[model samples]
Target: MFNNNKLALAIFLAVSGASLSGCGGGGGSSSNNNTTSSEPTWTAGVFEPSSEFKDQCALPRTGNDPYNNNQPYPDTAGSEFTEKMWLRSWSDETYLWYDEIEDNNPDNFSSVAAYFDQLKTFERTDSGAYKDQFHFTRPTEEYFQESQSGVVSGYGINWAFISNVPPRELRVAYLEDDSPAANVGLQRGDTILMVDDISIDTNTQQGVNILNEALFGPTAGDSHNFVIRSNDGTEKSFTLVAGNIAQTPVQNVDTLTTENGTKVGYMQFNSFLSIAQPELISAVNKFKANNIDELVIDLRYNGGGLLALSSQLAYMVAGPANTSDYFYYQTIENDKQPKSDPYPFIDFEIDYSNFEATNTSLPDLNLSTVYILSTDNTCSASEALINGLKGIDTEVVLIGGKTCGKPYGFTPTHNCATTYYSIQLTGVNYKGFGEYSDGLVPSPSPQFAADVKGCELDDDFNHQLGDNDEALLSAALYHIENNTCPIVVESSSAKQPSFTSQAIQETGLPLTIKQPLYKNNMDLTRPLPAKEGNNE
Candidate 1:
């Protein structure tokens, strides 16, 4: 869809002395003719398999090479695996076109993280946001284990820096059941007065860094102290040790009763993972049983995972309109077309989220309209869901902050130990549209231009999220009843540091893409459940 060309073609043709161009949308690499673009702020992100790829991409599965998982680790193992995988996946499979210089020179790395920096495929965006910000990687083992098992090890406090400037306060967003935070009586809307005896705030760089380490840098059995304030204005302190946290993606499922007896189902879908299917099914089935008139999907903190789940969730919401209709078309560079596939609404039984579960279809909500609660973290597959729903002409109401726009996604490929996640796919809806890097902002523009379905209203943080009276949910409820938006009344504009919810920051990793790996025995020829273009 863009004019940028010569990425994938540059690799193969360079050996043969020929030149070629790229195809499709979103990820196609454009020229880097700018005189100055800052060095990329790349970091290690988590790993998951891609549903659209079958190639090993890294060191050969049968090889005795150190870079291969079968062999012993080399001091240079990660770089070698990263280089090869970059050739197989990043260079060849990326939806974005690459320049000849960046395409052929893959040896510029002393570490895996450094190697990751060189694989980014966009010209520098100057407004302090990544026009092409989908680059990210993570420790392979940790991410793979967590994504597959729905578990993580940490303080278990889902906290957010709600203010951007001085005195940046950390507030509890929610708590995982049985987590350290939850065990210590910490709950949503609580304020963390101190972390590790270091007065935590966003005002100073040292404080934020210390807070980051205290929050995510520790292993199980590690302990940190925090002074917390309850909603009733009582303050207390506790020393909590870290432990393994089991994160259930569907955190809350309840029905809200309006004064007029209208039943609205509310579900806080945290992330898209294996556990999500069962949890989501359980919630939706209950909503269905209750005969819910409207549904509110709270994806405010969902960073996106598993394309299959995204498709499943979309189908569950749209039902018959989705049935045989196309959900998303995943496209790669021209050279790797064989690995590409289409994800339809009604998919055959394929293993998803590291488990082979029963049934191919998710229980459908079958609603004509869906209300989505969002934030900067509502990205990748979440945004893809919004795209898929809109493409099928389903009514989607977007409330809260603008969505973290990421039309791209990745499957974490690996060498030996380090899994390499390159931006290997650009997803489009049935009509084939995928160019929303800035994000699907909530605005009142035309459908295709403004991106999200409904009018814009910033989230209300006066109450905890998922509460019947929370800002975002209240807006959705308000709109559902009145058929118009509540006014964006003046409130504190400062927000905590959020990924995908806010612009690219110098202090954090850009978490723009993540999704499921292709099932090993996936049948590319699986037929649509209904006729093509049967949205009618």
Candidate 2:
């Protein structure tokens, strides 16, 4: 089922390459030169009229058709085969023709088999070649079964038996209606334990494999036995059928509250998908109505989505007038002119000319301070949003771990038949004050250190913090409480100064005089070294 070339094409386009041309001269004939202007022809290989191109191109004629004069042999089959053979002979010629064609462009070649053939001819070494190979193959049933069994075992779950987690202490995230999970009674925050007879182990890859087995069956309506631990701690067993699930990206909120009685607003942006802009505006309006004093945008796990959504969020936080204040930068290799100074890089400036505030009712929250909850998983659009916020002088207090270092974005292109590729041809480097590329590293202060140490001592470390503690959040809270903002200190100065030196500098008790009190033994208080000359 995964062998469908169209689906493969979609996946290929998600992460995909570039093209260049070279010329060679023919030794003997002007005929070769004349042929170059015309579309290149193809020759059929041993795999002619294979199942791969049956749907797209014509196949071997079997039955009589009126279009072909009621003959067993059809002209369409012959014509298609002739075209296929011509395409095979000079692949570049096919591409050239594809470029010239309006509807049947070469870029829209969406066949896996066609791409394979092209790769064999061009010998391209792009990453797409590897991914294409991986996706085209069909796995054996024995291989799949063993793989699933291995995953279940790794999770410390017995493949032949059922087990359950103790109830009442589990957190649940609900699967939406019509989802494979929803049909199985997998409500929001349902504490899952076992699928069929196998128990789940959180630390093992097998756990994920088992879930996939149950969730993605061979066909729709596939059922799986589930053992669940509900919120009330009751152990129950049920059967769930698999089906399609619609997933929306944005989660909105109207208001939040800080520890110091501060009424904060929140917008938990999960992704920059198609529905993000409208949802965000609606959420903002609700916050304005509620008189929110602060805004906390949680992007702790947003890995990114559409770039347009990122721009919209940036405009909302940074205001419409200051769109050009920041720019995203990237480095590109200019092979023709390799120089000593630097490579020619490009900068993509966020255009705010069309950003219109649909709701003029601005909230009570301080636009100068935007609390951004980040983490290592926060990447792409998340980074863009934070950078955009900073561009307009919004106090973007990033609260969490360092961001995922993936500032580069991609644009999609056609590779071959039914196969598309997304190439990371451009890089986004935010230019302006607080623009960063190494990612937002949390600067954990003394107080943050203390809180983490305390958590460790109490054995209450929350795994929800993932790899890093919520040090950035602590910094933001500190700023709100003490009215001191956190600054991005460079890596060179990450280490704190020595306590002895700090104490001496602060107290000024034992002063170390570097120079003589009076030079040349001049009259007492004579002009004081002309002011500028006094280094101290």
Best by TM-score: 1
Off by over 4 Å in 2: 1-191, 201-211, 216-220, 230-234, 321-366, 391-393, 414-421, 429-439, 445-479, 482-536
- Compared with the true structure, model 1 gives a TM-score of 0.75
Each model's C-alpha lDDT?
0.59, 0.37
Error of 2 at 464 (Å): 11
Find the candidate with the highest lDDT and give its number.
Answer: 1
lDDT of 2 by residue, 1-536 (tens): 01111110000001122232223211212122222233322221222323332222223334564322465532233223233333332232222122221222222234334433343222222222222111111222221222112111111111111111111122232233344454545443345576778655432356545654553332445667878776466878887654333333445464645677777666656555433545676776677678767777767646565444565465555543444434422223223212211111111121112221122322222356677766545665576566555444565666656665444333222111121212222233344322233455544332421111110011001222211223444455556665564454445413221224455445432212111110001000001111122231
Superposed on all Cα atoms, the candidates' RMSDs to the truth, in angstroms, are 10.6, 21.8
Model 2, C-alpha of 302: deviation from truth (Å): 2.0
Could you estimate the TM-score for every candidate?
0.75, 0.48
- Please state the error at residue 315 of candidate 1 in Å: 0.9
Model 1 weakest lDDT span, ten residues long: 6-15
